[model samples]
Target: MSVLLEFTIRSDQFKLGHVLSGSGDMRFELERIVPTGGHTMPFVWVSTERDPNEDLPRFEANMRESDSVQELLALDRVDDGGLYRIEWEGQPEGLIKGLAEAEATVLEAFGDRNWTFRVRFMDHERLTNFHNYLTDHDISVHIIRTYTFTEEGARRRDFGLTNEQREALVLALQRGYFDTPSEVTLDELAEELGITKQAISDRIRRGNEKMLRPLLLSSAAR
Candidate 1:
């Protein structure tokens, strides 16, 4: 049985750590991955609460200096977003290493202050092995929750939506929130989920992005 695991990692211990420091209001959203010679080039979308013109150069420079970052290849400005292609020096203590060792698949990975990743394991044993690997490296692993994956839910997860995002999307659809004549308001959805209005909105946005990205990629490929 496939299992889903949600966990957090300190930003400093992972990629883009040097570019983001002190938990400033910035976010790194993983866009795509390209396998290079012996490294992986991750194209990331970076957003900040401050001015991009002033901050992106600093971010690029920091990436070049970070020990985990092997090469800062490209940095492009896309509207209000900063896009980056970085050759990441593999970190043994990182989630990717542990997941690879355990033969697990990474579903979703995003966060600013700290990264929250949703990983899928083929079985409980693989999950246990992943946990042990991280701990053996002295990496503090924070397990949020683990649950069995449903076939229907797994199809919807191809876009990498987290559990919270998936719940919000399903609830909104069931409540006719996306209908022509909307059945529920943001505030109403927020109350129903016991979260703030902004929180619900953010979840929906992220969920939609995750759900649509795959479709867009396939279209471009063909």
Candidate 2:
């Protein structure tokens, strides 16, 4: 299940205007689109159920909210699957016309130097907990798809991720949280986030089973 929202913002504003807030370089596939007008623009978007932080608990928490997540959790028979709604309220005429004429819309794609390029999925605390865990232990737990159990979670407690080990992987690749070539050590990350090393390890391990096994190790390892 995948969901995405894309638009161009020439200035710094929110709601009526585009919101751009990201860092550094990135590599993305561009599937050209021919806009058909009215909320229909050419763009590519994908969705997954893995913990953005590479932790099950955190992933689970995020699942409860986040409208874009509706597809992923709904696809694999998610137990205690959450309920959400899609709403589209008519906007005032003036605001709508203003965005259609933003100056920055001439860009070829999302860029590091762009005035703004912000995108986000639903983020939950359980997933946050998992991220906190990996950072505390100083483990470069590579990508590995596997099934793991934490004292919490429903039956089977297994699923698929879009091939990302942890949120850090995205951050590292995109240069979101890192400013230098050196990777953010796990121990330092955990301390900054204030979580135990073992807890982080457990969350990362469990996260592997949920959809990130490809991240830290082999699928069998999880």
Candidate 3:
């Protein structure tokens, strides 16, 4: 199952760029960062202030030159927060959100600058015990948004899915009714859908098989 993860990162407190960008006020947190299979994704990283003209040139140069910085993106400042989206490789480091030390440091630094980041990937869950580990520390975290991660499909919706199928798929995906690395139970979803759990399970199984059909066939073709 393809899932979309979007993350909002706050700027580090020690950096001059953070304070200048206005990211210094409200701390940003990682919401989600899923995979994109390297299809040229959209990403955003903002500092503390709005007018970054004075410092953007140097920062952009450094970002482009930095070895650890993969494909980065810039976005326009929108209401509420900075908005930017990036297509990234096999899962950006979503695991870091679960780290107590890292989380603490990021929250502390957010007030110093404007830090905005968003990543798009495929697999939504594979952090091992990372999410739970972070929650164990008594952090107030929540999933702020949901995405289908189907730029291609949406662009060609006429041929992809029937309206009913699309709606079912979106709702199921959002509710985590589909199978995941973590053992997902269909009982609740089935109950809500007014169907038997076994029927729900069958639909999920079929849907997943359909999603992976091309890859499975390609392997056999080879």
Model 1: clashing residue pairs?
Answer: none
TM-score of 3: 0.29
lDDT of 2 at 83: 19
Give, for candidate 3, the lowest lDDT window spanning 10 residues: 101-110
For model 2, the stretches where C-alpha displacement exceeds 4 angstroms are 1-12, 16-35, 40-99, 102-222
lDDT of 1 by residue, 82-172 (tens): 6778776674336555666687766666778678777789999998898888777777657888888885366654565678888999999
Runs in model 1 lying further than 4 Å from the true structure: 13-19, 22-24, 32-40, 75-77, 89-93, 151-207, 213-222
Best by lDDT: 1
**Index of the highest-TM-score prediction:** 1
Worst 10 residues of 1 by lDDT: 15-24
Q: Candidate 2 residues 1-222, lDDT tens each?
A: 111123333322322122112211211211222222443222321122233233333434443344322222221212211212211123222222222322112212322223223222123333334334435533222322212233112322433222333543343345433456556655554464465444333334434554543444554686
The TM-score between candidate 1 and the true structure equals 0.64
Off by over 4 Å in 3: 1-32, 38-42, 77-82, 85-91, 94-128, 131-222
lDDT of every predicted structure (CA atoms) = 0.71, 0.30, 0.41
Candidate 1 vs candidate 2, TM-score winner: 1
Model 2 residue 70 distance off true place after TM-score fit, in angstroms: 13
